[model samples]
Target: MEWSVTDLAERDLYKLLVNTVLPRPIALVTTVNAQGHANAAPFSFFNVFSHAPPLVVLGIEGRDLGDAPLKDTMRNIRATGSFVVNLVDRALVDAMQVCAIDFPGDVDEIAAAGLETAPGRKVAAPRLAASPVQLECRETVSLSLGTRHRNLVVGEIQYIHIRDGAVDERLHVDIDKLDLVGRLHGADWYVTMRDRFQAPRQTLDTWRAQQGALRAKPEGEAP
Candidate 1:
């Protein structure tokens, strides 16, 4: 059941990776072209990588047959040096899919999807008004890989917008209010945050106490 990555076909490798990597966060990224035209796209290959500098990464792939190799999102990010990462919630899922469609460069995906935007505080790109959380980012660096036109973009967050009532004065967030959705296996599959459980970390003292209690019990008795 094991196959070498070098031996596998490109499409097969992609299928294997995407199918096995359960529940990846979706980034409904918004960017503006040089002409100030807005563009929106959904990318599952996205995540918040660091907190010190507040960085996020996006994996953008180019079209196989097209006059322009790079996707509109990638091209816009390169031209503007900024973008917004809008975390998708249950209510925004339909709009997110609409943005995922391969529309012409001239077409405005945000408008087509019937989504409203707010002016970015630090970046040129606009943020989705309905998103639970919107992070305005400036491109830190981008790495081009191979002939496939794949790019790994690293962006530093400048400003963040959280929906009102989702956060408290002490910076505590209410997950139920946030209500974000994530990408699941397959092309059209998605998952909600309703089903989640937390397991707290164990300290050395707590671990030793548990071990002592186990030893104190009699081997033959149910003590």
Candidate 2:
């Protein structure tokens, strides 16, 4: 039921990976071109990597198939070395989809999506005003991989803006208030955070005690 990666076609591999990944966070990234023209794009191939230096990673693909031009977001990032990651919540999903359209380079996706922006505190890229969370990031490094114009970008977060009432004085965030949405299987599917469960982490002592209790139980009886 398994096949080697080398044997699979690129599109097939992409389908398998995306369909099985299950609930990936979406990043509605915003960046400004060299002329200061703003651009907004949605990328599900994104995630926060580290908190020590506050780093995030993004997987960006080239325009069209082969060695065409780079996407607007990638091009802007390369030109300015700065961008903003706007976490997509349920309320922002529709606008995020509007930003995903493959419009011409001259088009302003943000305005097309009917979204407003605010000036970034640390980066030149403007932040999506409606996004529950915005992270201002400076590119640390970018690696070009394969012949298909695939790129992996690593950015260090310079500043973060969280929506009011979402975080408390102790910095504890209210998940219900955040109401973030995640990319699900297939092209048009998505998931919400409302359906969730909790499983507390176990220590070695706790595990040992549980095992001992199980052993002391009568045969075929529940502990």
Candidate 3:
């Protein structure tokens, strides 16, 4: 049960980490190549890292074909310095999966996946028509992590597109209306955010009040 990470292969390590991470948000990223061809792909290793600058990161892997070069998503971002991060929802999970296929560079994954695209207001890449939320971003950094397999792409969000009912001008996103989908461990597994709860943060005064209430209880009584 106690396995050393150094002894494990890269693939095995990846499997272990991803499986244990639990319910990662799927980023259905869209980018356009220099020739104006669109590429769409789904990546589970993506998240919003900063709010002040509105930054997000996507972890992309290299291509399998010897001459295929970098992934279409990465190549397009590097070429245009812009991309779109579309949030996947339960309704569009199947289409999102189709977009994850390793299609040839010339092939338009969005068209192949039978998904519609709308032009982004602040970026050149098209946004998924079905996604509940879309973030138009400009690449701030693209750091190569390993020799051949991984690259960390950091982007600064320029514009965000949310469904009319999903978010408001106050930045409050309706969780139920958004109906966001998260990736599970196994292949093709996904979960919806229909069931949720809110746990408010406790301040110093609230903590002290709670302690006073507990202390006021009878000496032998259960808490």
For all candidates in order, the CA lDDT equals 0.93, 0.93, 0.89
Across 1-223, the per-residue lDDT of candidate 3 in tens digits comes to: 7789999998898889888898899899999888888889999899999999999999999977687658888888989999999998888888887898877556677988899999989999999988989999999999998877578999999998888887777988887887898988867678887767899899999999999999999999999
- Model 1 over residues 188-220: C-alpha lDDT tens digits? 899998987898889999989988998999898
The global Cα lDDT (0 to 1) of model 1 is 0.93
TM-score of candidate 2 on Cα atoms, chains taken together: 0.97
Which residues of candidate 1, in runs, are more than 4 Å off? 215-223
Q: What is the C-alpha RMSD of each candidate to the true structure, in Å?
A: 1.8, 1.1, 1.8
* lDDT, candidate 3, at 86: 95
Q: What residue pairs clash in candidate 3, if any at all? A: none
For model 3, state the Cα shift of residue 191 in Å: 0.9
Q: Score candidate 2 by lDDT.
A: 0.93
Using TM-score as the yardstick, the better of models 1 and 3 is 1
Q: Which stretches in model 3 have alpha-carbon errors above 4 Å?
A: none
Instruction: TM-score winner between 1 and 2, please give it.
Output: 2
Residue runs of model 2 more than 4 Å from their true location after superposition: 65-68
Q: Candidate 3, 75: how far from true, in Å? A: 1.2
